[model samples]
Target chain A: MKDFPYTESKDTRSGFGAGLHELGKTNPNVVALCADLIGSLKMDAFVKDFPERFFQVGIAEANMMGLAAGLTIGGKIPFTGTFANFSTGRVYDQIRQSIAYSGKNVKICASHAGLTLGEDGATHQILEDIGLMKMLPHMCVINPCDYNQTKAATLAIADYEGPVYLRFGRPVVPNFTPADQQFEIGKGVLLNEGADVSIFATGHLVWKAILAGKLLADKGINAEIINIHTIKPLDARMILESARKTRCVVTAEEHQMNGGLGDSIAQLLAREEPLPLEMVAVNDSFGESGTPDQLMEKYGLNETAIVAAVEKVMARKTK
Target chain B: MAQSTASETHAPEATKSVAELQQIATQVRRDIVRMVHAVNSGHPGGSLGCTELLVSLYFKVMQHTPEPFDMNGIGQDLFFLSNGHISPVFYSVLARSGYFPVSELATFRKLNSRLQGHPATHEHLPGIRIASGSLGQGLSVATGAAQAKKLNGDQSTVFVLMGDGELEEGQIWEAALYAPHHKVDNLMAFVDRNGQQIDGPTDKIGGLGDLRAKFEAFGWRVLETDGNQFETLLATIKEGQGLLGQGVPVMVLMDTQMGFGVDFMMGSHKWHGVAPNDEQLATALKQLEVEKASDY
Candidate 1:
């Protein structure tokens, strides 16, 4: 069994809360606005510490987004929080106009992404959020992997000028990334390098890819595991460099295959470096009421799936 | 909730003549008709009707610096067009006010043009503070900007114009509840109750039962005005300005006709988005009557 440390497993939302609270202390310009998701988004620390700066938009996602955009005009860095669906599709026009099109410095923090938002089912689980957000011009899309990374990303996005969408999940994954590691916007991290197959992953699936890399090593199959957290402005150079060495690639993400990390990798490979690729993702299906583990198995987004995909893609490798 | 204590500080300057401003309004209306006609794809009726209102606000009322545009819009009365399809009127007014060169009006909806089909700040249009086209969102943005101005100790007012049909969007009401509850009295919202929408009459489509009563219910001080009449519109806007920062935001319900000045297009919903052709444009131009500052 791989050692996934950090005593009590904390949800990614706590990371966002901790980061935002820290941001409130470090940066006076940081302000948080929530649409009735303060408790869910773990923004209580920021709210308590800086009451005046935190705005409770009261179950109005559209108003919250607009308020965030408006707050930016006064040089205040506004961080808006809500569920993934409401953060994207419900308030797309508000975000498109007030923030993205207007070129405002607004941090759109969305939680409860993907099948991990179990029991709430397809209604809340937004697998297409990455696609919806990445399409907007001047919008930076960041899906941080673990607790530490999420916190770092939250803090980092607060300082980065212009509009950004920081997507995190509902469940707690391995907190392996260094807690003090500075988060870079468009850079991808290579976890373990190998030559047999390159494993590209994002969000919760990054831990799964790490485990798959270990498993593949045990099976005498070298796996180069790369963490691609930033989906848009994708780490194309990192992905291509790793893929060229391995000549085969497999992408993993807790999202739909259509517009997720796999599709991003495919587009990069098809244009720059052609390579045989396999994807371990939800295959054109909506999630249902179940535990996170059950959903991962049913949706084919697991370590076993990643291992299988690596083997399959490796077989098709020519060089 | 801290109440805003700052007073309105208008620039010490000369007031413009109604006739002088009306000339600009007429040319803007001409731009609205021509741009809509050139593409065969734009909203003209609401644009024509709101020309004088926009002219009164940008030219005569609002105090803003035309050069070295600032995004925050400190020390300036900011205007947001909620129903953004009427960009020709807005673009023309912005041009005449010197937000950009008047030459850009010719590139309204053409390729690589800053003047998109809908008004967007993304193209870096100087006068536009926010991108508005998706209805009912401009008021919320304006309310937020108004609140920001208050926070920054700036006494500038934030003005927004919305279509009567756009009132159907729930976000408008959400912002309505927030503005007065938070005491965001630095904001003024105007509803262009032109009585028409793309589908048909607003009452027939969705029925905005009682606009004044609705705004009043939302804790806004409601005022009514004839949007077509320059003096009356200016007087009403001045009244709205006088009532600002007095606990509740003021909403001016500007009653207007769809395609107000254009002869063939006036008084009906049919001119909502359809373009007027060559002969129709000629008749409309004749009815508009070129003012002394007929730069078009």
Candidate 2:
């Protein structure tokens, strides 16, 4: 089991806000456009520091997306902020023809993603965004784990060109990852090495996977924990190598099991190195108004779900 | 290939001449009919209807350099075609104005052609900056670009065109509210107010009750003109340009007849999306006389 040492806690969205402010100082061409969620998105610092570059677009996501697409023509990198639901579903067509089809370099930054967006219910929680964004050609899909990692990932994407969708959540989670770690786009970070089972997780579920690994340690089980941040360009080689040594796998994320990280890992293994796998994700059901911890437990996205999934897959291992 | 050499050799000594510009408009109309006839596909009615406005903007009003194409369009007037189904007219003017080889128009809608069903930047087309075929999104893009220009302290202006039926889209209103509230004074939007749409007239399908009053109430300075008549279009464009940087965005309601020059296709909504047959193509071509440039 991996020892994740940390004391502080923070939401991943604040990491994005901090990274955006840092970007304003590093690059003069970096500009931001928010659809009336300035305070919710934590974009107040950037707006206060660089008043000229920050654009308050009111409550119009469609127009904000089109404007972001057009801003790229003038050599500006535009980061548009809004909730995941309005960021993807409400403005899918505008993003499709204007940004994706046109091949514009726009950064679509989404916050309050998945069921972790407590109290908003299913109307605002977008579990289908990863699928909708990954299906588009030339889109780079990412879901960072915690505050420091999300901030690192945001700065990294600004240097990397092309259309990118950076998804982050609302509630505060343990900031276990290293604060100064450099984020690699398509590379997965190996948190712990083991020979019994492999655990792949993303977003807020990474900490849960670590806790599950510790619980498995007490039961005479050795587990490998890995963070699969980038979703679209799946790191198949790393996943296959991990499966070859561990012989079984467990995938976790706060999204629908149909098109989330579990589905991506399943597709990779079914083609390359077939292995027994169990998934810890929301089943086919909408969410209701509940606290963050209550929703995670109800939707089958927690440390117990990860521990149970690992045990289930371990039973299927031939070795 | 045929159009470029023929037009270049016989082009007017000065591109700034209004008489020469009117002559090119005649050839543009001929090209639109021929391109739509070749594929047995395209929107001929709206293309013919918007010819005068296209000519007035590209040849007379806009200040742009022809050869050295720049993506940012800094210090140059920028134009966007929001309703991109009317590609025949847009592509013809882009080519005739020397953005690309005029022969490229022959590849419209064919396999592996740069000119797709609509304008796209993915094909590496020079003149088109953003992709559009879906309605109601272009005005917002234009508004954003105009804001960028002002932020950079550049004096260039931005123009966008849309259809009457396109007003049914919710994004247009969202943009209408933002542009005026933000004081995006460098933007001008023109509606091709030729009442016909695919289902029927806009009033019957979903009425955009009083667009002039709607834009005016939304804090836009309004201007009206006959889009089909070249003289009225020139004056109307000048009037809109004169209203720039006045703490308000401008909107011009251009009244046009669908399939204006062709006798058979005019005065109805039947020709909105249908292409011309061989007989209809020949008839439409006969109505448009070849200019001295002989671009087609």
lDDT, candidate 2, at A117: 96
Summarize candidate 1's per-residue lDDT along B156-270 as a digit string, tens digits: 7788999898999999999989888888888888999998888888999988989899889989999999999998998898788778868889999999998988878887989
TM-score leader: 2
Model 1 residue A149 lDDT score: 93
lDDT for each residue of candidate 2 in A198-239, tens digit (9 for 90 to 100): 999989899889888899999989999999999978888899
TM-score of 2: 0.96
Worst 10 residues of 1 chain A by lDDT: A1-10
How far does residue B1 in candidate 1 sit from its true spot (Å)? Answer: 18
* Model 1 lDDT tens row, A176-218: 8888889999999888878888899999999888888888889
| lDDT value, residue B163 of candidate 1 | 89
Error of 2 at A76 (Å): 1.5
Per-candidate DockQ values are 0.68, 0.67
**Any idea how many clashes model 1 has?**
0
* Candidate 2 chain A least-lDDT 10 residues: A67-76
